[model samples]
Target chain A: MKSWIEKQKYIIDFTLSSLLRRKVKNIGLLILYALIVFILASVMFFTHAIKKEASLVLRESPEMIVQKVVAGRHDLMPLRYRDEILKIRGVQAVEGRLWGYYFDPVFGANYTLLVPPATTATEQAETEPMRTVVTENEHRHGPEEQAMPLVGAETIGAGNIVIGNGIARVRNAGKGEFILFRTHAGEGMPLRIKDTLSSASELVSSDLILMTEPDFRRFFGIPENYVTDLAVSVRNPEELSTIAAKITRLFPDSRPIIRDEILRTYDSIFNWRGGMMIVILSAAVLAFVIFAWDKASGLSAGERREIGILKAIGWETSDIIRMKFWEGAVISLTAFLAGVILAYIHVFFTHSLVFEPALKGWSTLYPQFKLMPFVSAEQLTTLFFLTVVPYTVSTIVPAWRAATIDPDAAMRHTGE
Target chain B: MIELFDVRKVFNTGKPSEYSALNGISLNISSNKVTVLTGPSGSGKTTLLSIIGCMSRPTAGRVKLSGREITSLPERFLTDIRRKTFGFIFQQHNLIKGITALENVMLPAYPLGERHGPLKERAMHLLDRLDLSRKAHSRIEWLSGGEAQRVGIVRALINDPSVIIADEPTSNLDTKLSYRFLEIVETFKKDGKTVLITSHDPLVYQASVVDEVVRLRDGRLEGEAP
Candidate 1:
């Protein structure tokens, strides 16, 4: 084993020297190879990060949300639906949720307004119950506590609202500042900015505004008994599907979006994007394979001569093939590592600029957040098999052909 | 000892372009002696050298290297014989471009899988003996033809094989360089190495170091020179 390793070390050293000697001839191919890996890896990294973010955020979502469907579109749900859902066998708790989209024509963006549920305030009481509850009740209950303001002696008023990072940036509004918006009655309502959500939550909470229930109703001119949706929490998660069916049978016009269904939808969305990229990348890969095949098939006369000289100098055909194998392995592995590192930096650090627009979709208020750096061992292995294996395998036939040629004839053949 | 009986070489067999390069030729090469084969361009001197050197298999023949029959051996065994028994010098220097002369000399030993330290020392010693120490680190493309040829010689001698097969070694050299190369061949002979060369040059054929001069015409041995 040690002797075999030593032999490989010598071959690898020779391969490195040979590759370095032919850097100019190979630099273009290396760049092309690395760029292809970079593009594919970036897409994969960004999608994986986004999927992770969605799953994290989905953990906080209600198990099921029951909405009223009117004329094939979502409409406001009656508050009585929450009472009816709470009576179901596996239903643990039900709460009416008030949320609506507020369009600011000046900024040309829509901001979501949500009223905090009462249970959310109780859950966040570790930071001073009265003040935290007052502030949380003033704005919709955002998931991150750092984004909630530290309330002192002052109590949250009905006219105050907490906004997301994107909304604050777009409106240029800071804490204690006032922003004016047109209500459904076309009346100008000035709301005080209470706090800004943290940038970490920007992916999910961007363009979001949290206000008290009374403030949300007044801004949207909604009646007191009507709510946007009914959030249902199940005591037995195993019976969630059963409870959802019961809710559907009880309320025929109600549409219940289960958390599992939402997760599946998110999965399918990312999969579809990934599938599209694979289709597009398959073409590029085919072209690259053809390029590689052509380059490998037509071994340069200089290379053939080199092989011929090695053969003449007592090197066996297996030795020459082994040398060529080292050459292919070195190039492909180097390119794969370079491309993956670049993609990691592009996605995690630089926020995937090349693929962000296509992946994040076309929206004026797109989230400005960094993706968490996460790569699986499976992903690296897959990339290795995809790029390195095929490339190394592709060179074998050419190397064998070059190695098997008559040394005397090969050294004399001058045609390029 | 190297011996061949009824050696025949045909190119492009079973095709319209098939032509026999050698026809039932037999020869004997004694060990530790300098022998020269002299022939015209199409007279199969190089082809005969290739067959004797184990670079190619003869179509019909029985070849023995040190009395071991090798004509019907598989390529793997032939390669082993080529590595351990014979060293080859081609007409062209055939030094791979884009690498230093020392690297070219070390190329043959690389496949032997020896320690690079000892290999480098041996290669350096050969280069030093040939007075090519200065040009050792120079690229083959930058080296003069004579210097490149010397590098090729160093590469062939790196393995220290018993048989040195030179196919028209002095064909590309001036008289001075040709004499310098023959002096090296003389050194090999003094070291008890068998040197087999094919040359059309009278300088090589008339040299006192040559033990015998075998002449060939139209694929047939014309007989030893007087």
Candidate 2:
């Protein structure tokens, strides 16, 4: 008799060839497995990439933000809170972040508004115009009309306020126009547009207007001493907690939010997505288990006899078991690879359109971004164990039965 | 060498209609000879063959093969005995229809733990001996009845088992092919290997090459005649 390893190789080789002989049947199984894998990989890849991007953004955000709470609702922080919080140790820089909400009647989304200082020449010109912010439908307004065209933070400058590009395209305003803009309080303010912002941000970039904090207060009828939130930068990263604690003690009305806490809120969305994927994938896996069980259990007497004959010819029960296991391995590995590739194309290349409908429910549109869906060795290893190992286990019972069959009874079995 | 003593095989144990398939039969088969076991349907010819082939064990008997008492052994150990010592040809061709004739022949040799290099060569050699080298790659579904039977013979002989058991190996073959198959069995016998076959055809009973014919009537041997 041969060594066990040698015997297993022969069995696996024969099993592979036998499967090749029934390509039609095996390929059908492969495709079915692939569909399950594809869906799973797609959802996993999209959610993973989104979380990765969000985390990257959060890591680069300010160390902490201070907001005022009024009966659990975030309200405008009084201007005096900044001076009091700044007295806390570990505070390096304190700046006001003017945040508000506005409704873009054209596109339906809870649009957050913010005011950041004009950091560039283009923005200096944009703030000069306190007119209507026209995003699209340019012909609806005269060319002389001053309009605030929403743009991105990167394009803000002195005397300029950039509204979101969505607002520009929707309102159809260009450079050097007077546009009427409304404050959160429904007060209309006239301003001359300097330039249109080129891009947007996930939080407020797409449908927001950025101006100097002082200008924002004047436009919204808020006091010079008022700010929606205060962004605090720590002199030492290690001092964040001490600074937060100090601010909490000094200013009871103001709450300091650490960067990680904000990131956690973002992180929870991914955890939810992950939980959903598990539930959905587990259902698919159950279906696959049933399909595989039915297929294995349904082997005819002739098939069982074939197994017996193979064993009688010197093949071990382990060999027969391995043969079936390889059949499963081939199917699952191929499906896994194919599915991952499709998911890659969907995430990185196609922007995950197919998945958006399922994931983005109630949102005006899915977030605009591309995902890398990086190939992590950990993920692949985990996926391999998830797919191939269970399938191999599933084949064991059937293979054992077939291998242990009575050779004489097996020899007598016919198709009939 | 093979021996059977007081072999009793009962089907559907401990039931109202329980009946013995093989009842307290005893026999011995010498190595390097041809033994033909024949009987009517339900006479336990197949049951006896099954025990001799190591496919099943006698419920209340002792069976010895190669001087080892195999009846008491676990089926796991008997598996190797069946693999290395017994080659079986059934009433049906029993070739896997999806595979080629050569693959079918190589099926039995798989347990020998030979590498592909040797298994393929051995399979090819056996196929050639059976005058099936040209049809080695032919699918079982495409093979003629004679060709398929020859494939079955190749499969049985590929592992070079010491004992060859044929259960109506000619049932599916025509007269010419049946005679040809018998001639092949005779050749195996001449090679000093043991051959046990069951057949209803008179050709087997009257064959000049047969060493002995053990006639069974309804599960009891009439006589072990020369």
When candidate 2 is compared with the true two-chain complex, its DockQ is: 0.51
Which residue runs does candidate 1 get wrong by more than 4 Å?
A: A1-3, A119-156, A277-287, A410-416, B223-226
Residue A4 miss distance in model 1 (angstroms): 3.6
All candidates: TM-score of chain A:
0.89, 0.81
DockQ of 1: 0.51
For candidate 2, the lDDT comes to 0.71
Best by lDDT: 1
Q: Which residue pairs show backbone clashes in model 1?
A: A138-A212, A139-A210, A139-A211, A140-A210, A140-A211
Candidate 1 versus the native: TM-score? Answer: 0.92
lDDT of 2 at A187: 76
Tens-place lDDT digits, model 2, residues B8-115: 888789999997777678888888888888777777788888888888878898998878899888767888888788887877877787788988888876666677
Model 2 Cα displacement at A331 (Å)? Answer: 1.4
Over all chains combined, what TM-score does candidate 2 have?
0.87
The sequence of per-residue lDDT tens digits that candidate 2 reaches over residues A142-208 is 2233223334444444446655555555566666766666665777776556654433233224455
**CAPRI level of candidate 1:** medium
CA lDDT, candidate 1, residue B182: 93
